[model samples]
Target: MAECPVIEADELEKRLGNSIIVDCRYSLSDPEYGLRAYLSGHIPGAHFLDLEKDLSGPKGRHGGRHPLPPPEQFREVIERIGGTESSEYVAYDDDLTGASRFWFLCRYFGIRNVRVLNGGWEKWVREGRPVSTEVPSARRGHFQPHPAAGMVVDINWVRRMGRGYVLVDSRQRERYLGVHEAIDPKAGHIPGAVNIPYTAVTSGRGTLRPKEELEGVYRGLGGRPVVYCGSGVTACVNVLAMKLVGLDPLLYSGSWSDWVSYEDSPVATGEE
Candidate 1:
């Protein structure tokens, strides 16, 4: 395929019936809800991949909630889900964070033909395009994945947060503030991380807000940046969003999950 920049919902709508579209509107925090939403209706020919179950491997005390699956296992998932050498994949969600995780996984596995659906499934439904209540059964794809090293970072790298490094958080204001304490044990955010929240960067059409707007947000941060969320996944979306704005960001793979797990790590509460 050509260069895979983010594509508009209209552009994706055109390819839906004819292409391999995956509805990745999953919540590791709420898998059942996401699946129920998908079962109710989804883009025709679209398949579903849950972030916790399908995209990520089993969680461990050290691996965080949505740790990356091993390459061989991920390759199995790719083939099982109909991802092939010839298959061009488009992943989307009502929430870009979930969709972006799949996109980031595709990149990490060196699957080059994948792209994020601009505006995602929510935009598709609003436009009155075709949708299906039944999930389609797909033949196994012949695709194999090669893992990329530079795409991920570990805890040691994350500890080096400043200097030339920038850290971004993708949680909402409420959750970031430690006001909401439902998910992780600790509710506060990592000290020194800026709150970007992911959603504020998009337009109504499901595409990114203009590059100028994004540049202003990144430049406002004033340095090379690293992004994170409750886990490492949504943070990747923030990085991808920044990529749309022409800003290349590093990934804090452990993210807040790892941050909070340690007793001595700094935590900040409340909105700023």
Candidate 2:
């Protein structure tokens, strides 16, 4: 929530010339969908960032489907997007997930001046805002990434985290309960992790809810919140939600997918 600051379409339009706007529209089901969408039309002067290619690292035995991109690769993305320490960076996506993902990475890498575009590209296009097929190349930036220590946690950390932390499962209730499993191999969630679907943080219009509503969504959660979802993608929504409510949250980058990769990792089903 820088408590995940967001820029509305109007404000973004006004700041388009000064801000580094990126189009991060990606679909998990279709690997090439995002690039095709960008090619069709995108925000004027917006650069495209592919989800798998740019935002995540290579998948192997176990780091979830979308682990954080390598430092050098991500730094290149930042520089390509003209992300200087002082520059304002704005990101937008179709489902808002990509925007939040972009925002989380920006903060994780110590870029403090980044924000998601409110309501995403849907809102912008619905309002008849400018769209262009021509892509723009940004001037290379001198931004060096300063990754925050412990902002992200690994499997061992989560395994031994104990009950001191509030482990929030940022997935749908069904997914958390193991009633409906799709992407990952095993169903169910981390033991002791409370269900707080990432969708709770946003309005139906794909914009973040007001602070009051966000507070309601996270009420009664006291300890430090550690959030995760399938492959750690949607988890950013919950992370951003915690940020909005003035709570510093940690990301379980491996999420459920990684948890299940280990045969002995405990899995809990149904509501506690």
Candidate 3:
């Protein structure tokens, strides 16, 4: 098997002192949830990084709900978190969503030594590993951002690409079918995207499925895929899952929200 982009909890425990462990626990419904959890207790030496403030940029007419911060801005964030280009980053959330977002962001900005913590915070706690409430002082880190081209595709590109690529909707089937939309002004999905909810990549325990299992799940998706979701957060979970199976997929960062922002863009409901 190829080297996966995930680091298991036990492996993380051994690397805690040397690596930068970021507690990326976040809730879309409650912005303060992650910080509160971090303050209450987190992995020893782990620093808290907020999703909205740190991970995303200002929302506007387009670019979806969670936009990527500018390269320099992201570089500053890396420095604030005491992360250098050479530092190994291990990001964790209660589930893989937030951590996967961090992982994708790091990769998009060309930070190569980043990985998501497999099974995340819940698994760490379940294992009864060490936890702490102490927040460490920021150490100045010399990190530079080199944003990778083609790592993320904008809405216009997605529009041009059309159904040529395997367009994957990483949201739940209901959201894809326009049954219920918790967020975004409109319901349904891009005209041709197929539903492949991010949850399929994980087991009931919230950890990712075995590599072979994940390969089987994505095997028939056909070639390199283009993955998207409500606002581009969970889509990275699919990207991570694909990488674990040795498949490289592109991300539609603007995703469905940006798609709906344009009134002329077509939307489809019901399963294909």
Candidate 4:
């Protein structure tokens, strides 16, 4: 069995100065704040990764705010940012959005030596870790992405799920139930998909639960799970959490947004 992709601050501290600590904090409302915080102070050896500028490409009709960067492009970005085939990566964000993106991308690309900071940057700063003001000079490295087979599924692929794929919606309950609409124009979820909001995968304080707890929450569903959100991005958080609990889930990249865009797709509303 493989180890999970989550690590604690203390465990991370023991490896400091000898490992790659990536800061994935960014705000769509005020993007500059993350960079400013990095410039002011970050984990002593941490490298800052911008969500829009680094992890994702320009949004198009097909993808959302943080679509996965092209493979070669991300291979280069990861290497240029000090990631190597053997490097053990620790990614963090004040919030998990950015860190979760990093976690998913690395896992998707086949970078195996990676982990998410359980409580992210807020906890790091609170622990009084050493900080740095100097921008890092990256050393290019070799990164080979070995995406788990069937980890990503598109709209056409999802249409085949009765064959055995399980679609799990990661949106909030209200949105999943069609009572609320905020981010995406679509209000409901994919037909036959069960709800397990991304936020629920973690504690109120934003740390993942014990593997035993996660196993129970997911096993109760009684099937292999395929995770999805409005777009593909946030769904990775759920995937990462599943991995933490020993479950491997496929991601539906073209999630609710893509589903609703098609005239013939089915939609379901109301709580079950």
For candidate 2, write residues 102-164 as lDDT tens digits. 888888888888888878888888999998999897778877888886899999999889665
- TM-score per model over all chains: 0.90, 0.96, 0.97, 0.91
How do all the candidates rank in terms of lDDT, highest first?
3, 2, 4, 1
| Alpha-carbon shift of residue 72 in model 3 (angstroms) | 1.7
lDDT tens readout by residue for model 4, 156-207: 8888777455789988899999999787777887888889888877775547
Per candidate, the number of residue pairs that clash is 2, 3, 0, 2
For residue 185, give model 2's deviation from the true position in Å: 0.7
Largest lDDT belongs to which candidate? 3
lDDT of 1 by residue, 1-272 (tens): 54545777777777766668878876554659788888999888888887777788777887577788888778887887778755678888886777788878888888777788887887777878788897788888876777887777777777765587767888778888888967788888877778987777877635667778777767778777778888787786677778776676777777788878877777898755
Candidate 3 regions with alpha-carbon error over 4 angstroms: 1-3, 162-164
lDDT of 3 by residue, 55-173 (tens): 88889998899998888888988999888887889888887988899999998987888888888888888889999999987778988888887889998888888444889999999
Output the TM-score of candidate 3: 0.97
Clashing pairs in 3: none
